[model samples]
Target: MSYFKEDFKYDLTSSIVVFLVALPLCLGIALASEAPLISGLISGIIGGIIIGFFSKSSLSVSGPAAGLVVIVLDNVEALGGYEPFLVAVSLAGLLQLILGFAKAGIIGLYFPTSVIRGMLAAIGLILILKQIPHLVGFDSDAFGEMEFFQADGNNTFSAIIASLENFNNGSFVIGIICLGLLVLWESKYIKGVKALKQIPGSVLAVAIGLILNQIFISSGSALAIGKEHLVSIPILSGEGGLTAALKFPDFSAFSNYQTYVTTITLAIVASLETLLSIEAVDKLDPHKRHTPKNAELKAQGIGNFVSGLIGGLPITAVIVRSSANLDSGAKTKMSAIMHGIWLLLAVAFFPTFMNQIPLASLAAILIVVGWKLTKPSIYKKLLAVGQQQFIPFVVTILAILFTDLLIGIIIGLVVGIFYILRANYKVPYNYSTGEFKTDDGREAIKIELSEHVSFLNKARLQTTLDGLPNGCHVMIDGSRSKEIEFDAMEVIEEFRINAPERDIVVSVKDLPGGKGRMA
Candidate 1:
């Protein structure tokens, strides 16, 4: 009871914040995908309500991901229509389910900590860059794109240049005011005040944006944010609007090869994004809780399945929403679920009101969110950790800034692996040498194996063994080692066999092989 009360108390404030944050993003991603406006809402609803209800995660929020917008747009065109794409989404959900049952979710665990941190930082930086245009009502670039290269062929830097000419002064004014409000709302003193803690600053930003928009209209002010700069969710009119909006998948295309191809593509992309976001969210969670990866996959499958049924685009655990939820003081999955409920109510009875919101306001909110994700303090802390980690972390940020998310992560992982192998190869074992003569007064060398010496140390060990002098006692000690690679052990044995040729005495103590283990 106490836990429930504590969690619920946080949920109310956070759920509204997440809802406000997610609303425009959902619509923007759909606009980028060229999907129906309602499709994004459907996916957001399923991701928040259904996935959150079924998932064991305490903080992750699922939704229509911007990462999938490109693939969705392409597949929707290739498959000839939106209805067939829904079928692909359903099949993708089944694929996710099978993958979860196959235990493929453990793949996320293999990513290095440095690479994950780099991913978070890179995403933060991307959010700041990509949302800047929207902050000023420049809509030339694809909405919700986080990659360096855009769907319209402009890279991140070029897009910013374009935004300069495309800026709307009205949006610029609203965004600046909202940004200031959000920043003040997040200040230490304001957060420390108990009364302000009950109401989220993002919710207030939305209200302010709406009121200011109305004031601009009623006063006949030329500075008013127009329809293009505001959210434009189609207002539903009674039961007919709901019926027309719900798109069902057509199974007639089941035998089409493109259908299967689209399914496989969506499944792989969505699952990977879901896993990556889940890992990222776990890192951001204040309580240090871990979301079960396999369970998360299963929940995503269910969310996508339901989303597809309702004519929505594919669903994934979206990092933007998850991060927003975490930053807003979410303590349980209920925050996510309630956010979905808020989406449902807004879409059902209040879309016209929602449409009054300025995109600049939401952009300001995300700008603040992005700033929090990659604060200079985080950068300084990573740099303090040392070159081995900081190199990979920074490499990831640069790669992601210059490329896409998955590609950037892969690049960072490769660099991280290279550093790990280099570090391991440099010092796989510890050694101390003494001129302890044998009974014949010949000097000997003693080498001690370090714990968990892997295959990477193979060549180094062989080189040292080859340098042994004739008529000398050589001792290789593995007594202190808990794990030595079989290959290393074999190298020891080979040197032992070859020692006779050099008139050298070779002795390996507690080496894992032969009758012991490694042989």
Candidate 2:
């Protein structure tokens, strides 16, 4: 009620927008997953309403994720049936439940900020590229999968080329018209209209596309849009009869070794995707509210369990839908919930209306969404952060574009680790030249150790100590140090014991007690 009182209007309006954005994506991701289209819609409904209710996040939208398409497809092929795969998804949900209780979501903390940004940017670029073919009326390929290679036997770039070779003039015309209308809808004038603001631009663009498609067909033009170019959603036979769509997992398959392997793989990948999307969504939140990681994992786990029981793909928090919700001015989780309601209704009652919509019109809307992700400001900011951050960010983008998401993330992490170690490998001790009077009026130089000294600092320390003037008194202090690696301590002790050879009187301060060493 509080949400209704405070943000119901905004949430409801944004829900329709998200529902529009999510509809085609759900179908496209399902196509890429090689799963039944109904499975994708079921996951979307469960993800939004079920998971959104349980999650504390204000803006994270969950669904059948593009990141899992390859994994799901491969698993399906290996498992030999969709039912067995459903069992794996259910087991994965249980695994996520255990992980949530165990606080395994803490692993999200280790992903570097640069890598996360890189991931989002790469997805954005992929969105733009993947939609190009669709925008040209090339309906053979799927949209929103975000993989380097597509299900239509084409890679990202090759699809664009093929679309050039095979494209419909009507779809191209519709795409431009829809894109123009979308641009205008975001303008100040259109936004000024209260009623117009309530109706999302995507919905309008789709309506126009439907009309244009009808006109083209009626005119008997060569450029008329065909059935293949339009959306196709299976209509329900009747109301509240979900029994036909519901699919139960074959629990008997649990004994198979491959089942556990697929289950574990799904859990791990789904968890990573969820954590990453949550991180990205937080960045997009206007209120700057933080989501509880473990709670989100548990919510997703519960949703996947239900979705799996009813014949759905594994669910994860999805960044693209979350971003669209944020930009559309959603204020609460209710928007995500309502979007699910809309999806269910569309499938059950309004599928005929949905089927008339053109894919090119949807592509035009996502093109705008994709542009939002790879804004010039983002790249400029990353560049200003320096090479350590920018390199991993760019490397991640290239890796994801060339390989798969998981492999890309792994490569980005490796690069981030390299930067982390490079930063830490420098000397730890502070070198401040201070002259002190010894008992006999000799000048002594003192060096204080930092909290922890690793062997990586050995070279600099050796250089400084070796360059010290002969016959000078030197004090090597470690009183404040919590740890000193053996190799580093060796350098200090060697300097201490070899003092006479260099005609230098060396004294050790707070040297750690140990078994016999040269004193």
Candidate 3:
């Protein structure tokens, strides 16, 4: 009971913040994918409520992801319509279910810590850069796009430039005021007061934006924010309201080859994105709780299945929503589930009120979230960790800033692997010279093999053997090793065979294949 009371208080407020952040994104991503506007809402509802209910992650918020926009657009067109695409989405969900049962979620465990941190920082940078235009009331591009290159022919930097040229005064003022309010709310002084801390800055920002715009209108001022800069959800009417907005999948598409191909693509991409999002959210969780990856995949599979049946876009664990949830102090999955309930109720009963919300207010909230993610202190900390970590971390951030999320992660992994291999190359074995000599008084060289030597150690082991002094007694010890690769053993064998050519004496000890001296 105590846990529920404490968690509910935080969850209630966090849900409202997540709902506001998710509303525009759902619509914008659907618009970008060329799907029915209501489809996004349907997917968001399923992701938040159903996925949240089933997911092991308390902090991760699932939704229709911006990452799938391009894939969805192309497949929807190639498959000849939205209904057929829904068919593919359903099949994809089935595939995801199979993958989860097969424990494919273990794939996420392979991502290095540096790469994961880099991904977080890169996303933060993207949010700050991409939200700038919306902050200033320039809404030419979609709301949730994180890719460097946009569908509107503007890159991230170019969009910022364009926003400056097309700023709206009313949006500028509201955004500035909201941003200031949020900053003030987060200050130590405000947090010191119990009363002030309970008041969420995001809600205050929304209220202020609405009231300021209304004041502008009542005074007949030109600075009034127009409907174009506000949230625009499709309101349900009294008659046939639910049925009119909902779409159903065309099951006949199951026989189509293109549908199968699209299913495979969606399954792979959505599962990967879902895994990454959950991983990222787990990193951001204040409690540092670990989420079961396989459970998350199963939850996402169910979400996509329900979404597709109702003619919704495919669903995945979205990092933007998940991060927003975490930053807002969500303590349990209840926050996500409540956000979905709010989305449903808003569409059914209160869309007009919701539509009054200015995009700038939401943009302000996201800007703060982004800042928290890519703070300079994080960079300094990573740098302090050393180059092996810092290099890949920096590389991942730059790569993501220039490309899409998956591509950037792949690039970071490549850099990380190179460092791993280089480290292995430099330290294959422990080489030392003993002052005590053999019976004949020749200087003795000793090479102690590592516990698990692989093929990566072959070259260095060979080099060490070749550098042995002539007429020296050398000892290669593997008695302490757990396993030695064929490559390293071959190098030792070859060196022993040719040792007499240089008047060198070779003695091999307790190696796996053989037990005694090859002198």
Best by TM-score: 3
Q: Show where candidate 1 strays beyond 4 Å.
A: 1-4, 435-437, 469-471, 514-519
lDDT of 2 by residue, 15-34 (tens): 88788889888888888787
C-alpha lDDT of all candidate models, in order:
0.85, 0.85, 0.90
Higher-lDDT candidate among 2 and 3? Answer: 3
Displacement of residue 258 (Cα, Å) in model 2 is 0.8
The full ranking of all candidates by TM-score, starting with the best, is 3, 1, 2
lDDT of 1: 0.85
Q: For each predicted model, how many residue pairs clash, with residues at least 3 apart or on different chains?
A: 4, 0, 0
Residues 51-125 of candidate 1 have per-residue lDDT tens digits of 999899999899998878879989999989999999999989988998988889999998888889898888888
lDDT score, candidate 1, position 192: 92
Please provide TM-scores, in order, for all candidate models, with all chains considered together: 0.95, 0.89, 0.96
Q: List model 3 lDDT by residue over 297-393, tens digit each.
A: 8888888988999988999998888888888889999999999999999888899999999999999999998999899999999999899999999
Worst 10 residues of 2 by lDDT: 510-519
Candidate 3 Cα errors over 4 Å, as ranges: 239-241
Q: Worst lDDT window (10 residues) for model 1?
A: 510-519
